[model samples]
Target: MIVYEVFRQERKGQAFAHAGSVGAPDAAFAEAYAREQYGRRGESVALWVVPREAVAEIHEFVDELQKNYHRVDGYPLKEKLKEARERAGTAPPADR
Candidate 1:
């Protein structure tokens, strides 16, 4: 029996999540198993059943440029807010 990885979508326009795995004899059986196990109770609106062998595991990621814009620490929010408040004449006393 071949093992299949199942991804399920709960509703339309939503991202599919990893539901689970199932052991089946073939692609058709894998799909049928996925539907019966995941979608039969209305738990999932859609299911994707892919053979385990077809899935690839990614281990390393390359970030040579060291981009940080996506991280919270990348933006100096506190400093900017303070500067904005000072410019607007609403900043509290520095001693406070």
Candidate 2:
């Protein structure tokens, strides 16, 4: 028997979430079992059944060096805004 991972969409336009698993001898059986187990009551609008062995497992993600430049806070917009305000004569440059 093959273990199939099931994902179900609760309604139209909704995202599919992991429903559960099913053990079946083939793809056709897996689909039937997954549909019955996850969508029998019409609670799920769609279903996807993938063999568990086909799924890739990722346990960890590592960043060798910390990088802040990609984040919005990495840009010092406040300093630039202050400079622009002074140039526009909207406000006096701070005495700092």
Candidate 3:
């Protein structure tokens, strides 16, 4: 395989994300190198290493077409907040 996958966790109960990639001959060497390359400073709480051939990769995620309706910006609140503040007679404290 042309690439090796490496993942690292920030701390206990945290998620693991892609840290980097390296080249190696076997799983033993790849795991050793990946640990050193990504967790040398004792920064990672855990790791996962896999060969490129054994791992599946996809770059064409559909984040572009899929709207994030659960995101903070997805909730329209500017007009509602302005009206609420006006109703409460608390007009957004003067800008500094």
Give each prediction's root-mean-square deviation over alpha carbons. 2.5, 3.8, 4.1
Model 1 poorest 10 in a row by lDDT: 63-72
Cα lDDT tens digits for candidate 3, 6-96: 8899899999998989898878888888888998899998998877678877887676855768578777889899989999998867675
- From the highest TM-score down, the ranking of the candidates is 1, 2, 3
As a whole number from 0 to 100, the lDDT of residue 64 in candidate 3 is 85
Best by TM-score: 1
Each prediction's whole-model lDDT (CA): 0.92, 0.89, 0.84
Which regions of candidate 3 fall more than 4 Å away from where they truly are? 59-96
Q: Which candidate's lDDT is highest?
A: 1
Total backbone collisions, model 3:
0
Candidate 2 lDDT over 48-88, as tens digits, reads 89999998999986655656687787798999988889889
Per candidate, the number of residue pairs that clash is: 0, 0, 0
TM-score of candidate 1 relative to the true fold? 0.74
Please report, as a residue range, the 10-residue window in candidate 2 with the lowest summed lDDT: 61-70
Tens digits of lDDT, candidate 1, 1-96: 999999999999999999999999999999888989999999988888988899999999887877878777788889899999999999998896
